[model samples]
Target: MAYTFEILETEKIELVIPLVYKLNNGKIDKAVLMERFSDMITYNNYECAVIYDGSKLIGVTGLWFCTRHYSGKSVEPDHVFIDENYRGKGLGKQFFEWIYNYVKDKGCEAVELNTYVSNAASHKFYFNEDFKILGFHFLKKLKK
Candidate 1:
């Protein structure tokens, strides 16, 4: 299958919102996700990398480019989700390769992400990709 990779414009974030909804297992409200996406695009400087198999979206992931004291300019990938039917087909490795090259061209020194602790499958995949656990990702939800 021919695949296309694109950096989805901030204004076009809604294109990937449904895919992200699947990432969250449909637990969060779409309205809430929309609001979060608005904030992410407007204030958080979020970018989304998407893969399409001839106009049908197969994978989506959020990217944040920033300067971190420890890593200089880095790309933090978040909420990475490939369609259920598309897993185990090497699409993810291809997607990451695309993202790595894309960010490297942008002068990114590293890639970081926070995966849910309970996502054993993600842990395995990231480990296979050579990602290491540097520290815990603690969170305190102030409001919901």
Candidate 2:
């Protein structure tokens, strides 16, 4: 199967919003997605890409560049996802490898991402890709 990755655009927001909602377990709404997409495009913080199998969009990934004090450098890779039906097809690795090369080329010192503790399959994938777990990330949801 031939797969291609393309940077996201405003015209593609409708297609990408659903994919992002599915990937995020529907925690985000359309307005939120629109706002974030707009910010990503405007500030150039978003490196959103869609994986296409022929004419179908089967996966999505977003990378944001940021500087980390611990890493003492700029890092990329904020999120990645593949449609449930398209998992285990090596697309995840290909996505990461592409992001790795792309970020490195852009002078990013590292690429990082987080997977939930319950996501064993993702942990395995990251391990296979030679990503070492640096530490645990904890979060507290605040009332809006």
Candidate 3:
């Protein structure tokens, strides 16, 4: 029942890569992801927040701190995933509460996140957490 949350550093990101892949349906190559994540950590101003049950990792998400004219300081969390075995047990609620407090401590005025439209369960869960639908997240994947 005891859990911990920590802001992950670059050297430890591999610990959460498995859970991160879960968000993308396990389609990403581990080697490639590790390389890209390392680059992101090194250059893209992103950090990962990891959830641990005792010493074992149970969930992970990416956090990007930003400022906007309307929102001021905010933290945007992405790629959130809880271990399949740990879902639907109020852990997500605890995680978000922790994230809110974490962001506030960093002088953030808001927390924002995006979830895939087809993920209805997440939509309901987020709504239950008092999150409002702001707008659609449009993406255009450029050819590599």
Candidate 4:
């Protein structure tokens, strides 16, 4: 199947909120997702990549660019998801191949990301893509 991809600009990020909702399986309200995406866009360090088959959204992923002391400039792919209708079709691999080239063209020396420990499927996918475990991704949420 033919597909199109774009790393959406801040002004067009609303296109991604719905897909993010799907990624979260509706655990978070769409309104709250929109709000969080708005905040992230405001930072100007994040953008989202999406795959579309004509008018239908097939997948979405978040790309965070930053200068890490350890990795220098890097692109972190977050919340990667391909629609259930399209999974196991090599779309995930192609999507990440596109992302890898995109970030490398932009001078990213490394790529880093966090995935839930429970997401064994993603861990397998990432490993197949040659991503190695560097260390634990620790986190502490703040009171809001």
Q: Each candidate's lDDT (Cα)?
A: 0.89, 0.76, 0.88, 0.87
Root-mean-square deviation of each candidate, in angstroms?
Answer: 1.4, 2.1, 1.3, 1.3
For model 4, residues 1-144, the per-residue Cα lDDT tens digits are 988878877787788877778877799998898899889878777888999989887788889999999889999998788888888988899898899999999999999988889889899999999899999988899999
Query: Model 1: how far is 91 from its true place, Å?
Result: 0.6
TM-score of each: 0.94, 0.84, 0.93, 0.93
Tens digits of per-residue lDDT, candidate 1, 88-110, equal 89888999999999999989999
lDDT (Cα, tens digit) per residue for candidate 2, span 43-131: 65566777888888887777777778877445555556788888878889887777777777878887678887877998999899888
Model 1 worst lDDT window (10 residues):
39-48
Candidate number with the higher lDDT (1 or 4): 1
Give the CA lDDT, 0 to 100, for residue 63 in model 3. 88
Ten contiguous residues minimizing lDDT sum, candidate 2: 71-80
* Backbone clash pairs in model 4 (N, Cα, C under 3 Å; residues 3+ apart or in different chains), count: 0
Residue-pair clashes, model 3 = 0
Error of 3 at 98 (Å): 0.7
Winner on TM-score between 2 and 3 is: 3
Candidate 3 ranges with C-alpha deviation above 4 Å: none
Backbone clashes in model 2, listed as residue pairs: none
Clashes (backbone N, CA, C under 3 Å), per candidate, total 0, 0, 0, 0
Compose the digit string of candidate 3's lDDT tens values, residues 6-107.
888778888987887878887897887888788878756487899999999999988899997888898889889999899989999999999998889989
Model 4 clashing residue pairs (backbone) = none
